[model samples]
Target chain A: MRPFEYASPNSKEQVAALLGTSWEQGAILAGGTDLLALMKDDVVTPRRLVNVKGIDTLRGTSYQPGNGLRIGALTTIAELADSKDLAQYPMLFEAVTEAASPQIRNLATIGGNMCQRPRCWYFRSGMGLMPMTKDGKSLVVAGDNRYAAILGTQTGAYFVSPSTIAPALIAYGAKVRIYSAKASGSGVRELPLGRFFITPKSAKEREHDLKPDEMVIELIVPPPPQNLKTGYFEVRQKAAFDWPLAMAAVALQMDGNTVKSARVVMGHVAPVPWVSDEAAATLVGKTITPDTAMAAANAAVTKAKPLSMNKYKITLAKAAVKRAVLKAGGAA
Target chain B: MADDRPRKPEDNSGVTRRDFMKVSAVGVAVPVVLGSVMDAAAEEVPIQGPGKVPITLQVNGKKLSAQLEPRVTLLDALRDNFDLTGAKRVCDRGACGACTVLMDGKPVYACAILAIDAQGRMITTIEALAEGDSLSPVMQAFVAHDAQQCGFCTPGFIVTTTNFLQKQPAPTAEEIRHGLSGNFCRCGTYDGIRAVALAHAGGKQS
Candidate 1:
């Protein structure tokens, strides 16, 4: 890793001020699992690092009976997986445990996981975020793209979102609380986690809707409904230390034996967590069976535009969606 | 809420020789900026360097002090400065578990952790596992089962297994497989490793 000035601040205000307004000026260091690797490869060379791990407010997970679940940004994946309070939301546990490995889970924070740089080979090789040739042809479209996005590629961003827990979080209607010292009033703002991700059009932009100085402080997941059932599933190359080939998360609000409403989201198959409204629509007002689950799964990938080497992802994605939906509905 | 703070000027000049020289020349500017921003705080925050800074780490029940840059990894600090070569740096990246060590009794990759960040935490390396002139229980199990081939991945495996057994003394078959999945053995000594880990966990050897 490159040499950089390190500032350990105890408060969010100091952190915001210490951070640079751009990637080059400074970078936030929570769990260095991702940032250190990026720095070692010279992918991101920040002049200063604001280590926010010292901030006491940005760690822990709390859930109130009538209220919701509030997860501190610095909570590690292992903590999230082991929390007894999160057992009601089994999808969160599954997603966290299904991530990298024990050692990585111990160090990697949930916030860092959400904001991690893309694992696209082209991007890692120092090609810009929207990797392109000198002639402006997309390298991903023209070259090997086995792990690239199958959905939302029309914007020229082909790299798949590297988040494993995002689909499950979004399925549960999670919202991110962002903190900025410069902001007026409370200096905190909230946004739906699903809307936080964006497909950047250029190298100057970022994959998430975060300003350089602003940091995610907390994730607010609303209380699970009495009728709600959620499931998370991932199809990966191996059981551990592997990014998902394709994954899906499903949350079903059942009316007795019938599905009253549903949310289906797929990950690693798109630039963002691909929220499948079509699949959710297909499942509403119907009882979950093998056939209905399969139909909903088929509907989930109907609009996928796979690159040459990644057509197999469509099949894997369908299987994930079907399995996740069936698991949510207690049909499998 | 509106962000009224004026945005800092962007330095799109990229990482060039000129930029490096400029950064070195103004090396003191970052701390000044940070100190100014944190003037209102109850406690003053100190900014350490792009250069070496003094840091003390509690490793293996001893407080070891070393001067290290902010960018130096725990693995490098352990192996180079402190001479604790037990944690092997195989994949430098977090993929391989050869750099595994215990931070606050939880397994973590030393390569992925910054040495400065590891301050104030208890770090246990492979060297701390055994008593004087005697192999640790985990090490003995590895030997008894012939769990090592080239032995490059043994330190990490033993460290991980020692902690894993403490956490789940009677781990199921599935748990054993999942627990050690983080560490990779290129020599394909997985069966031996599994046998010993299972045997150590008090499960009947298959």
Candidate 2:
């Protein structure tokens, strides 16, 4: 790695000032599990590394009586996975546990995982940042796109955001706290997890809505409903140390036997966590039987347009949703 | 490929003369002079590096402090700088658990963690498990059951098993398999490893 200056800031203000001054050439160093790998490969050549690990304010899991859980950005995956407050929010715990191997989870931070780069082979392996043609055409169309996007492929980039926790958080209606340096009165802003992602054409922006100099401080998960059932399931090629091929996060509120409300989101299937209101609509006021689950699974993928090699992912995604729904409904 | 035939001893004189000259030049006093110089250099160097970043790292029951690079991994900082070599570096990636160490009382792959991020946390390597020449109960059980082969992956397995047993001391066979799934042994010593964990859990060995 090229030599760069390092700063261990003690306060969020210090970090914000450092990042604000050096937006283009500076990188916030969280766990360094993902950022260091990107730097070592020269994918990102930041001239300054601001270490945020020293900030005591950005650590630990907190729970209030009515407001639910608020996890600091620096909290490790292992801590979130084993938290007692997550017993009622089983889908969140399940997603964190199924993310990576034990070692990666120990070093991977919740904020870092949500803000990680795409795992697209073409974008990661080559010299150029984005895979392009000689005439500057996107190369992902004809490349090895087995795990690429299935819904947002009409736009140029087909890479899926490799975050297992984002879908679960979105399903639970979580909110993110962003802190910026330039602003004085309103330095912080909160956005729902569903509105956090902007597509390439929509915003002409990055995968996430975070500003270059803004830092994600905390994530707030609303309290789980009283009669709620939740489950997370992922399909992987191997048992350990690999990303999921496709996954689903299912949350259901049941009134005795009939479904009161439901939220279904699919991971590794789009540029962001793909939420299907159609699937949720199919489950409302209906009993969670195998037939209803199959119908909801089919409705979830109705708008899905699979690429040539990823047609099998449709089936894998369907099975994942079905299994997640069944598990959440206590039928499996 | 061209020089298949053996050369005569006269042709080998060049090599012998060089070897003889090398041996004579470094005879008896050379080692003594070099050792003193090395000792002086070692004395001049500080025990910890610069910046002396304040970090409270509790390994076993002792609190330790060291100045290190921000990019230093927990595995390298422990093994190379602190001389805690029990956690071996096999793959260096997070794929293998040979470098497993307990951080905040949970078994984690040390290679994947940055040293700076491990501040204000408790770290436990395999070196702190036993007291002096005596072995811990888990280590004794491992020896009694012959649970290691080649012994490269023993420290990681032992540390993981120790943490697992602390949590679920009387784990069933299925739980044993599930808990040990994070680690891999190339020599296929898993059967013996499981036997030792089971034996220790059953109070069969001290």
Candidate 3:
């Protein structure tokens, strides 16, 4: 690891000022679970790091009955997983618990998990942040793409979204608060969390849509309909301390025994949290029986164009969808 | 936030080398800090390198300070600078969890945390766990169950188990597996380790 200047800033304004031009100049250090690994691997060499863990405002999870939940950016994954009140939003609980191992969750922040880089070997190894061929060919097109994105990569650069928290949060209608002086006076803006991801069109692009000078201050989940039932399911290569092969989160709004509306999001299979409109369409106005779940599962993977080695992911993704739907519908 | 106010140089118990050299003119033996200030008679303070910075850390129960580059990991500082090498660094990344230690009572990867960033928090390395000739309870359990083969991953697993079993004294089978999932042994001693954790936590006796 390279030497860098370290500062424990008290306010978000000071942190934003220290962040420098890009991720390489000065990086934000929340929990250091992911950032240290990147530095150890020589993937990113930031000359300075601003530690925000000491900021008092960036720690807590508060809830209001008619309003929503406000999750501070520095809230640890273990703290989030241990909150019993989050049982109402079971998708979040499931996703938070399924991430990494227990030791990692003790140090990994929810915001860092949402903004982490990909697990693509090409990205981690020094090929590039977004691996590509010199002649504009897709390296993952015919290579070992077992964990590559099956959706949202028709052109090039197939890499799975590494976030375990974003899909569930997006299904729960979450918004992220970005704080920065670069935007304007006392700059602050709330963007829907679903719009936070940026897929690679060319090799020079980074993953998230965040500006270099801005930092995610908090995440807000809006109040949900009382009849909504949510579930999150992930299929991993190993049972512990490994990234998932495919995962799905479902939030179904029920009217009696029938579905009024639905939000189904599939992750680890796309460049971003892939919202499955077809699966949602199949669930609305229909009973959530195993038959409907199967139909939705089939519809969810309609756009999955698997790479040469990742054809198995399609079946795994479909199974995750079916399981998520059944679990959300209270049948499983 | 009261912490936002900067501290004056006179109010501090510690100072940079340049400040220490100026103070050395009045009192010959100023105070015995973690490092030797006897060389201050040179009449000049050496300029620190770009990445090098002096940091004071209260490691274990003692305040042991060192001059280290900002990139030095807590694991490296413990093994190299402090000469406490109980925590092994197998996979330098967080995946293997070979360098787990108690940070503010929670097990974290020591290798993944920078030494400079760990100043204000309480850090407990594996060297602080034992007393005299006897091993800790978690260590005894590992030995009793014959849970170790390579022993490279023993410190991390034992530290994690000691912290975990103290919180969950009566762990079920699933809880034992889930609690220790962070540490992995390439030698495949999980079954023995799980049995030891359960027995030591009073599961067998209960």
After superposition, candidate 2 runs with Cα above 4 Å error? A21-24, A126-130, A201-205, A238-242, B1-68, B116-122, B130-136, B140-151, B186-189, B203-206
What is model 2's interface RMSD? 17.0
Residue pairs with backbone atoms closer than 3 Å in model 3 (clashes): none
Query: How much is A59 displaced in model 1, in angstroms?
Result: 0.8
Question: After aligning candidate 3 to the native by TM-score, how far in Å is the CA of B162 from where it should be?
Answer: 0.5
DockQ of each: 0.41, 0.09, 0.25
**Candidate 3 on B1-206: residue-level lDDT in tens?**
11222333223232255433432332343454522533322223222222456766777888878877767889898888988788898998888878999989899999888888788779888878876578987788789888999899999998899898888988998788788989999999888899897797667622
Q: Rate the local accuracy (lDDT) of all candidates.
A: 0.86, 0.74, 0.81
Summarize candidate 1's per-residue lDDT along B1-206 as a digit string, tens digits.
11122222232222244323332332334466576544444244565666677889999999999878888899999999999999999989888899899999999999999999999999999999987779987899899999999999999999998999999888888888889888999999989988887897777886
Against the true structure, candidate 1 reaches a TM-score of 0.92
Q: DockQ winner among the candidates?
A: 1
Predicted candidate 3 versus true structure: per-residue lDDT over A1-332, tens digit per residue: 76555656666655554566677666888889889989888998776677888777989898887868889999999999998658568789888887888888988898898888888888889777566677766677757787888888865768888987899999998999988744775588988898888787777787787887788889999878889998788898777677788989999999998999999999999988899999999999998889999999999999888888898999999999999999998999
**Model 3 CAPRI quality:** acceptable
Q: Model 2 chain A: which ten-residue window has the lowest total lDDT?
A: A16-25
Query: Model 3 Cα displacement at B153 (Å)?
Result: 0.4
Error of 3 at A288 (Å): 1.1
